[model samples]
Target: MEPTILQGYELAKQLYAKHGIDVDQALRQLEKIKISVHCWQGDDVKGFLFRDQELTGGISVTGNYPGAARTPQELRMDLEEAFRLIPGKHKVNLHAIYADTQEKPDLDELEPRHFEPWVAWAREQGLGLDFNPTCFSHEKSKDGFTLSHPDPDIRKFWIEHCKASRRISAYFGEQLGQTCVTNVWVPDGYKDVPVDRMSPRIRLKESLDEVFAEPLNPAHHLDAVESKLFGIGSEAYVVGSHEFYMGYGLQNNKLICLDAGHFHPTETISNKLSSLALFAEGLLLHVSRPMRWDSDHVVVMDDELLDIGRELVRGGLLEKTHIGLDFFDASINRVAAWVIGTRNTLKALLRAFLEPVDELKKAELDGDYTARLALTEEFKAYPFGAVWDYYCASQGVPVRETWLEQVRTYEREVLSKREQAAAPAQL
Candidate 1:
């Protein structure tokens, strides 16, 4: 989608003239409206729901997960299958990969000989591919080098993967008419140090430069860069929250793909509100729901998840952005999970897009930012929570208040144990 950038600016300009609003700021902010996914599991939920809703433009996916595809070859098959099953009309990007250094990470072992043809065939079949290595596990990334890893041998491996990923990406672009966006999220940290001491980024950037060292290529264009704020385990190495800035900001080929859930551990990180501020900066979005200290479950319509949708629009991050859905249905009811999740997904998005535009129109004519903001914020919590509640209630579903209490109670117990272990014995 070309995104209504100029139109949005013109609208903002007129609204400013008519209502004395900050048209300049709105217009400036409007330049970075991105609607894309941070992560995804290939499926039809998006096509079935949001394409018609006119909310998101695409979704990101990692085809290797949720299946027995451990090796690169196995993963490629699963990847192809997932893409084929993607029953949506939006762009499909890639995210979340397994590292080679870590105990046979999927795709780490994949040679271009294997990947090149598959990605080519996928293009023939209309499946867009997001090619990159995985992080989050220490075994995968002992020393991070996006384009460059610290170990020379590992660097050699990384360089080869870069070549293959780039080739596949370029191929996808040509065949699909869309850029093969690379979201380079790596875990480049140290176990004993106060911070990620190694200059893994040095190698990472070098590798990236090498990948892009060539002249213009149609098949691949580095679209976005993703960074995270938290990690999975004690002594687990998490690259800096803004590490991608050095890599993507310096390079012309990339954009910033912000994950709202990734920034949750910080109290001051205003969730999706921050995406607006980041939007003004260059690069677009890689949308997703981060499980944050827990399993990376693809939540459908949690309070905070839906809130991210509202923030994206209100912050002007939805204008002409390359947005995608990166959700995980970690629930036992995989099919039902995908369905209700997607149903809620469209509901949340429609509320964000339709209601906000409607309110913005009314507020402009009636001079009611207070009323408009209130209405939007009121629905910010979740677009479909009420409808879901009504449906569940009508169906006589068991109340989840008790389930919620039990989970919270367990968390408290675990935290209390940890705190006692850290604290001195009581007198």
Candidate 2:
């Protein structure tokens, strides 16, 4: 590593050691935490299965930025570039629609063979893989209903899709020797006020039961349910509301995906972690930034992000919680978005790990609220940045903003070429 980084880290270590914190131990823990990078961000949520299909499910990726990946190869290449810049080994989150196969198959007909390429790539990268069932952007879900559709046929289609997704998820785990979380998030609700919400929820419950009928080994496969408060058309009632999924997840002993953008504007998922950690079997966190709504903006080093890191570390919930990024911002350079968001997440976690938690807890227990508050605020100005810089250098990733130059070089060469080749012929 650089001499400056070493010098800074030594100073940071001494400062942290004074507070009964072990910088080396913190770095070791940070090295093991892998953040699952979302794949859809590279291509603005457009997958290989139906590239022309308009994004449904109240999900929207804004901006027409140049160099969006056009094929599975291009997407993987872009992801490789992203991973090269980001430190540590991290998993990639793939949706069902990202299936790569010679023979086209419908959602319900999806099989593990279709995702063999992803597993192979993950293996080559020494990384893990996570999956999601794409229950939106399809003809069957055109009417804004999926698992809870009143029509039994439509409901069966979604159920079969979810089941197929589980098998594929298990396949990923079996191939890579890591647990794959298969999250189910359906866009089933009404545009306006609905009188009969109970029936749809009942149907949804039955559909989920059928989807999870065939038990899969937890070591290879894990099931998770994600809930959203409201969406574009479903502004009034969202079938899989927080309350609905929380209860379902607890009763069914499944992971509950808490999306930062899926809740009300004021509510934060950080506070919910403690309660869910106690009751839920596990948790899948969709770290994101919501601008006024479920806009899915790129994550930044903000207060909420820090709080989330603090909660996860302080509550000792990292082992049971699957950390994943969920925002897709097409407005900026897509690859940079991945690096920025993933790096910021790591920084937050590192900051949390470096915290003098025992001291803070003791102060709180001893009714020394002033000391607790003072220490909490005081540590905010500590030399965590030096520690972060050292960590980045140790991981062989570009330190500070130096990574952006590589991204710019990539954009100037590879991304710009793609944009040019994709542009229509000049008159």
Candidate 3:
């Protein structure tokens, strides 16, 4: 560790100690929390199985960024680079479309063998793995209806895909010795106001029931359902709205995935955690930054992110909540996006862990809102950055913006070469 980092950490430690906060204990807690890094960021959500397919189902990755991973191997290489820069061991979140196999298989026909390479890689990296069924961006879903499609055949196909995904998720957990969460998200809705919204929701409920009919070991695998407010095509209404999934999740004992960008711009997911934590089996958070819509922009150290971390710590919900990132910014260097988002998430959690929670609770309970407000505002100026820098150095990652230079070097050597090699041959 740098002398400056040690000196700063010592000062920060003493300052925090004055407030009854144990800096070392906070670091230990931070070390144990892992953020599941989404794999789609490396390749702009364009998985290997169907490279020629257009990203449908209201999903779009803007920007013709250079060096987008063209193959599974390249994506893995980029992820390895990202993992090296990020602190601590974490899980990789995979969608079904990212299947790596010689034989081509449709989504419904996908099996555990299709994702063997991912498991093998995760094992080698000593990391955990999470999964999601790719219910969108397919021929059947081109009409913007899946799961709740009126066509029985189409609904059956998606249901089978979800079932297969659960098995694959279980395989990951069994191999990695960590429970894998298979999140289900579908873009089933109408672009215009529909007269019969009830039928689609009813069909969706039945389909989800059929999908979860098979009982899997809770220790090895868990199921989660994600809801969206609206999408590009489904502008008027989304079939899997929050109310639908929240009720279903509570009744069926499934994890409800609360995506930060999936709700109305005014609504924040931080406030929903406590209420959901009370009834839901578990929660899966898809942390992302949305600019007026579900843009899937890379996450930054913003207010909502901090509030999310604080809620997890203040409510003691870390053990039950699975933290996974969900964003893909094709406009920038993909690997750097991962490092930046993951690091910021850790920083937010660290700040929350270093808070004098007991004191704050006491102030609130004693009807001293003034002190509660005063202390929180005052603590914002504390030397939290020093503790973060020390943690990064101790975890073998670059401290602060120093990691950016390494990313630039990687772009110059590896990513730029990929772009050159992929360029059309000039006559």
Flag the better candidate by TM-score, 1 or 2: 2
**Least lDDT summed over 10 consecutive residues: which range in candidate 3?**
418-427
- lDDT (CA) per prediction: 0.44, 0.93, 0.93
- Distance from true position, residue 423, model 3, in Å? 9.6
lDDT of 3 by residue, 1-427 (tens): 8899999999999999999999999999999998999999999998988888899888889887788888778888899999889888899999999998887899999999998988999999988999999988889999998899999999999999999999999999999999999999999988899999899999999999999999999899999999999989998999999999999999999999999999998889999999999999999999999888778888998999999999999999999999999998889999999999999999999999988999999999999999999999999889999999999999898998999999999999889898777633211
In the range 1-427, model 1's lDDT, one tens digit per residue, is: 1134334435544533443444344323322322233223423222111122221111222332222322333334434333222223334454323212223234344433444444554566555555544432223343332334556776665555555556555655665676666555554444444444446655666665665555546345564556655443313444444655534544554556665455554432226345435533344554445543522455456666556556666666554344555555422322323333333444455445434454466776798778877765654543233333332233233222322343344335532243335322211
- Pairs in steric clash, model 2: none
Question: Alpha carbon lDDT of residue 385, candidate 3?
Answer: 98
Q: Among all windows of ten consecutive residues in candidate 2, which has the lowest summed lDDT?
A: 418-427
Error of 1 at 378 (Å): 7.0
Off by over 4 Å in 1: 1-87, 91-113, 116-127, 135-149, 195-198, 201-203, 215-220, 233-237, 243-247, 250-253, 266-286, 291-294, 314-316, 327-343, 356-370, 377-427
| Residue-level lDDT for 214 in candidate 1 | 56
* TM values, all candidates: 0.57, 0.98, 0.98
Please report how far candidate 1 places residue 306 from its true position, in Å.
Answer: 2.9
